[model samples]
Target: MTRPIQINNHPFRFLLYLEWILLAISVITSVLPHPSPRFASRFPELAILNLTIFGLMGLRLPTSNNLVKIIYTACGISLIFITGLFGGRADRLFPFLYIILVIRSCLIFQLPGRLSVTFVSFTLFLTTLLYRIPRYPLPPQAQEKFRFFTLSLALVFGLSLVFVLILMNTVLSERESREKLAIANEKLRQYALRIENQATLEERNRIAREIHDSLGHSLTALNLQLETALKLYQANPDKAQSFLARAKELGSKALQDVRQSVSTMRSNPLQDKSLAQAIDILAEDFQRSNNILLNRQINLEYSLSTEVNTAIYRIIQESLTNISKHARATEVNLEIIINRGSLYITIQDNGRGFDLEQNTTGFGLQSMRDRALSLGGKFTINSAFGCGCQITVDIPLGRLIS
Candidate 1:
């Protein structure tokens, strides 16, 4: 025996096992004739043993290994032989044992292998019929006629059982295929949902950076200009008027920029332009409006995804905003270079910086870091309280470049 057949408990498999139990019950019931032989006294012990062996074919254990399957198959084949050889001439239903054997063989073996089992079953039934003919006290004419009818009926039943087994196998194979397809579709749906969630989170971070960069920077600059105007009210009357007028203009521009950021998220001062062009415009405006010295060197000459382009622009904007708010510097230098599919940005300012470890409570540094990370970039700040501040952002450009 190669191995035991193992199958899931589908309706068809249950029927395969259940059929043997029903067949055994049928044979045992018919063993003792009702008129002359009732259930208790008329049924022979040998016939009862035959029914027990047939029912054992359908016995299911908790776990069946190769050894268990081998033993089970041997017992089923043995029952067929025992029934034909010793089931007695009075038990005319011994041919039914061949039907049970053929069905069990179909479940365990392939087509060629099961055909071997079928041939053996036919030979055994014919030999048993010949053996019992002499024992039956029938004359030559009646014995010959009985042998012909028994062989013809067994042949017909065997072919019909083979056809039914083939149909059951086809149905079970189709059911297994449909179940695999359903599992694959569910995995694809879960993967799509995860991608959508990640995109939503990145968009939220982009918007936060935008609001902080444009509006926050403008408000800080406007507040500084107004303070200068207030102190110069009596000492320098004409300069105070000039400073106030510039503060009012900056306030109006800040309001417009905020509206533009909200109305069209993609519509920045950098609309329809390259990232370098956008950053240049931002630097010029900050220098002219605040009367601060700004120097920039940028080399972004390739097309990239909108999200990446937008992320880079906002990172620069947020860095500039933080400098304006906290850094009391005279000159700032911004350098951007793209090399080997990676963009590097470094901003250095000659300002009084704070301790990185102690003053770790603001959202400006955190916002810049978040923007860089969202776009597969890295952000690093190098500074001290007395010395100056240097901010570097490195972003990989291979994945999101357009």
Candidate 2:
């Protein structure tokens, strides 16, 4: 059989120990060598009653429900009243009453419940006063002393109530701070996940474009050359040999192109240059390789943080790949600008455009939006049937660019 693990050390337990020490001191002070015989007789009973209530309070400290707490409080208050009545020293019980009031205030309750507890405590105090003055025989000189004692006890109770309220306020404030921190951490995790997914999608789009541009074009040319070689193999043997050689050359070029594409895809550009320079290099490469007329316009010379630069570069790369694959047009324009502490990027294509609503499952546009949103940015795509597509991204400076 396994024994239960004992991990009893905690801050709340330490506080309870401190409270017990304080209660012991209060009991010792109230009981040691009282001048009045009646008060002396009641001291032991008062101490035992206080100890019992303190034990019950320790048990109830972890509870938060109003009904259960009210029950415990009522039991403790009834014991206090009974001890006072039997001991015939109402003034001696005021300290216990004050402590009970403080415990009652700590209960998790609405305004109505708090007011109800306050009313019950006040009623008990008044009832104790009425029970004590007439029944306990005293001289006129002793009565003045009793009045002063009652006033002092009342002041102590008021101060104790204020202290309890302040403690409760501090507990509530700490709890709120913890909750806010948890929510902020959850949001950050979600943002990071979105960025990861966008990066994956961009990698896939680049691979697809490479297959279409290099491999597909090469295979088409090889098929055409083979067909021509078959038609002229006997009539023009030399021409047939030349056609086969050209087909072999195309095949070799395709393999080289695939190797180069894979090598460049694996390189990390953001490690060496600023985001602006990286984007300029990408635009330059696209213009050099593709037959489509590429017009690049960068209107700003702003610096971005390393992570923001990488995200931006990936978005632009994905956009260019989409244009190369689907946008069958003659011209494409790319623009980058910084306005009001935000990095804005626009990629426009003068190609046949598809409906944004109809192509919602297309990963390219979704990936672009996810990339922008991950960096605390806004992404918008505007296009319609027969018109070209324009993607606009604006990332906040405070969140990403800074």
Candidate 3:
């Protein structure tokens, strides 16, 4: 992409000031005394014409059309030629004007276009030098020195032009790369914010579902049992006592479910515990809450980062919670191992599974999947009706530590 040159802006004001400074120097030199008095009258008019063309070129610099840039460059070349042909001490001013043209070309063109302008500037300098060579005739001995001096000057001027072109190209390329990186970083930041908000919303919904599905049912059942006990208090004392006992049990169960939901909401689930310790605590809680027999084969031979540790803990926690809530199974298989430079985790249950095609995007399952993916891991689920559900997560250890 091209950037327009704003002469008043901070980026382009320095260039504007430099251009004016160069022009002032050229004008001052044109009015100074020179050995060649006949060229004096022509200097003032040539200087005025050169100044006018330079000002016009600056005004038209913000255009992107190649045709306009070519015309602008042509105008600069013609002015340089006229100044060299008639202005006193034109040799001193020719290089500066040509350099200025190259600078302007950079603002309007890409690398290929800039290179073309530099080549033309070098060629024109040579042509002007040759045209003015015969004006000062010298003896054979002095001519040899003059020719050597002339060739050296051309080489030096050509090198200077190439240097300026390369410098401008490097600066512009660096600036472009930085701009692209900044845009990419901004996009990433926005995406991260969206993901965070989505996660928060999903967590809120999950808690609401737990309260409605588990605690709500228990409290409703408890209320009915308490009402039944009240109704039978005078009719039958034994029946009323049994109903009161059942109501107390339901109330305790509802309280336990509420506690579990609150525990899940903790900011740091691990709480300074290692992955194995955290999993053991979770297994104990699962066994206490449900009748399922958990068979764990955990071999965490390698240490893990906090992020990985938390992810693993949450994935397992979420899986067990799902199994307890939905899976009517007597047994669960939990496996975790660091094998072949990767961490592998698999949680399977002998529960009556649902259709994978129809229930592929549950909130709990999605939360687990997102956790795995954020760490550059893979998460997959396999299940069918009457068949047990299986979830496998594989994460590269090298990626985690880095």
Candidate 4:
């Protein structure tokens, strides 16, 4: 069974109320005195029948079933024909029934269907006028006046129908546009939420890498120094004291690394330093902490943005940390140069390298790769067992500055 139309929830509740008011007036007008006494009393009953059919059709309203709509419309047309032929009534208010039919058609149909229904209603109205004209015979003296009045009434009704069609179409089109805009806003909200989640995850991973590369390495070296100092305490007093000093230094370095990592979380890694100055500090710290020989050649002629500076600095720092922790390299080469319209960076180490495929998923390597890619650059690492590893990055300069 079809569900009943919920009038309270309808968008056009005002239109429905207007329909009721107009139909009530029409029924009241149909019962008044007329020239033809034969059907004067029955006209009220016919008007009541029309109202009953309208009420019945309203129950089946807001439906998608084409057959149901067509049947209801036919019933309305049939009532119009009966009123004109048998009742001999084509009064001024009668055209309102056809207008009501057009209103209902607007609710049920699209543009093409609406136009078709309006055309049919107008045509039926003309037919009703012609059919009732002969029955209500005007005298020859008033015939011209009656003809002019009839033509004026028809023209007015026609214009009213056109105005209603345009108004209903405009209202429906605006409602549809608002609905589509609401849907688009919801989709954009979901997309922004997803982007926020992804950024949060990446930040957490970066913090993890920073902690591992800085505090982790310093603590490990501190532990080894303490062990060495314990072994030499009794055997050699001077060496034991020196080792103890180095252990204290390592402990201080670990604390400093923690503070730096905290600062990095709150702001950019380089703070206010130039990329060249930041790299120099990183190189000095690495050499002071390890017994590895480092060679550097940096050539940056143009000023770089904070994002580009951070990317370059972090990539170099991560590389140095990885080499100190696992590479077992004695010598490392670092180079940064700008050529044509691109920045190129290369880091090579004479370390006992592991298989590249096996270690590609390491946090340090992934972090460097993410930084390079974020700068719209390419990062490639090549390594083999017992051979040195080389990492090269190339970033375009044109779009970066622009």
Candidate 5:
């Protein structure tokens, strides 16, 4: 990934401000009066150094992009060679610009890349020293002063260069850290959003199942009673009146059931009731609606999260629904157990089951599995053609502890 540079960072701004300050100092020292060499002889070089600094200031360098960076790096290398060339005269002030050139390099190069520039600077400094040494036509007195000034500048320049490189290393390190942290935070945000969406979908599915099971069953029975009342109106008015009364009662019950399901969807009543209590209510309702034997053995003394309670309720509710609609079973065994920090439940029916391969997605099996897994539980079904069906849900208590 491409890590973008932020010039506004405090460390980066500090480096920029230091570069400008060093530039100002180099300019002031270069223009200082030179008594021994004659000011007239050094004036031209000083003027050119000032003009070069001005030119550099106007040549806008990019803070990003590899191509622009390469061009800027070449410009810095050129400045180093120019400083070495003109700073040669023992008494001249131009060599002070070496610090400015080092600063220029610090702007463009990262760690270890500066070592290449450092090597180049050392080679050029040595060449300048050789040219300024005694073998030239200058007097020994001048040559001695030249060696002293030249050697000292080299030592100080090398030290200052290393220091600047070290500072730039810190800036680069901080930049990388900021980028990594930003990326990690972004990933965490996306994960949180996914979790929220999944919760919403599960809730919507639960509401849908409640409405289908409650209203569908009630409305179907009401319609049959009304049709029977219409047929008996001519033959037996009293019997027809009884059928009409039953239909009216069913209609009222269906309306109340719908409102109750909607209210439960809005929030969990199970929050006030433990899983055992919720399952007890579910068992009584299932037995009344389906006219099937529902044997219960629930004993959850400890409270689970509302989510776990809701999942357990929905799974049992959906399983009972599937049995009434398709299982053709008259009796079902419901058992809940806790052992070794695990919650296990078994819902088995002596219903006419079908082939596993052919009926893979029927009987609301997929939804029951999804609900169980969402609670960090395992769901399994055992059944075959003409045999009974059994659904087992196993959840570790560790998942509920949190």
Candidate 6:
């Protein structure tokens, strides 16, 4: 696999420049002052050639192909062989070749490939040592000098490899951490957006329910009174006058109710009443207005949090309004039960019912289900032609009943 090149930070770049400066100084010190014409001509030329290759490697050119590796290996082998031909005098610069090989291995290869390059470089160093020992005579003073050179070479190569590996691992670790944090932040944003949308939808449903319950019913009652007055005017003048007066009174009351419903629907109603109480008021008003009997059986007394209460009340109000408008029912039954950390509510009407599956897309039923789901609740409706409609809502207590 081809690895991307990363530009190092200022401190690391400074260290790299320092290494190149040191290599230049070593080459200059090894070559100057014209020691024997044959040694001077050949050795300095070879040292200059090796330094040039090191400079090229530092530029960080692309190495997706094996051409760069072949060039680097050939240069390394040539420098090692040339230094060996010069014997003990040139052997002092062997550490430079080791340093360059280790760095090139790290840049060109990943961990496993770097290890293979390291093993090969060490083998070449051993071969150079064995070749030199027989040609140079070991005097007592030169024995300690040879040992020092060997130790220095080992220290430079070993320490450089260890430090480079540590630096690469640290960079990889930091990159992975940043990626994970980015993913987590994205998920949090999505969750927050979902919550905001649900809140807006619940508020809209509340306003719609208030319109149907308070304003819609009153307007319908006023309309009925007006129709009655128009009929009575031909039969009896006094009765028609009384009916007209009642119609005017009903219209004025309805206008007031409309204003009140608009104001309250904009704000929160659950701040004044629990969810169950809100449902009870709605059922009672509906019962009184339509002259229909309501059988309410509630076993739960717990008050839900404000938002949860608002959602539940809207759902119940919508279900009852649908019954009043379309069901043509004489009696409706409402049952609420809370048990084992679950809130269960069922509303049924003894009226002409339509197919639940086929007519599932009706506005009132969809609104009720949407309200229940917004609170993390489940809603189910069951009905068939000529049979009563039943709606069941089950909400987890942890989510809404608290």
Q: What is the lDDT of residue 269 in candidate 5?
A: 35
- lDDT tens digits, residue span 282-338, model 6: 677677555678898878767667877777776776777778678889999998888
TM-score of each: 0.64, 0.53, 0.62, 0.85, 0.65, 0.67
Per-prediction count of colliding residue pairs?
Answer: 0, 0, 0, 0, 0, 0
- Candidate 4, superposed: residue stretches over 4 Å from native: 1-5, 27-39, 43-47, 63-68, 83-92, 136-138, 205-244, 253-264, 267-271, 399-402
Q: In model 2, what lDDT does residue 289 have?
A: 41
Candidate 6: residue pairs that collide = none
RMSD of each: 6.4, 9.5, 7.5, 3.5, 6.0, 5.7
lDDT pick, better of 2 and 4: 4
Question: lDDT of all the models against the reference?
Answer: 0.71, 0.66, 0.78, 0.78, 0.68, 0.69
Tens digit per residue, CA lDDT, model 1, 117-198: 6677777776776665555478889977887887786677567556655764576567668888888888888988888888
lDDT of 3 by residue, 268-362 (tens): 45779888888897787576446589999999777778877877877887788778767788999999988888889999999998898898787
Of 5 and 6, the candidate ranking higher by lDDT: 6
TM-score of 1: 0.64
**Mind giving the per-residue lDDT tens digits that candidate 5 earns over 1-402?**
333333443335554565555555555555555566633234436544653563355234455676776666666556645654554232244344444455455555564546766666666666766664555478878878877888797888677767766766666678779999999999999999999999898778767655655565567667767887899999999988988987897799788887887676543436587777877876775675556899989867566777777777778877777787778888999998888889998999999986777876853677778778887889988889789799999988888653
**Candidate 3 clashing pairs, residues 3+ apart or interchain:** none
Measured by TM-score, how close is model 5 to the native structure? Answer: 0.65
| Clashing residue pairs for model 5 | none
Segments of candidate 6 deviating more than 4 angstroms: 1-3, 6-33, 37-50, 61-94, 129-138, 144-266, 274-277, 288-291, 301-308, 337-343, 373-377, 395-402
- Candidate 1 differs from the real structure by a C-alpha RMSD in angstroms, to one decimal, of 6.4
Candidate 5's C-alpha lDDT? Answer: 0.68
Candidate 2 lDDT over 16-78, as tens digits, reads 565566556555655566677766645566656665675556544424555666776676667
Judging by TM-score, tell me the better candidate of 4 and 5.
4
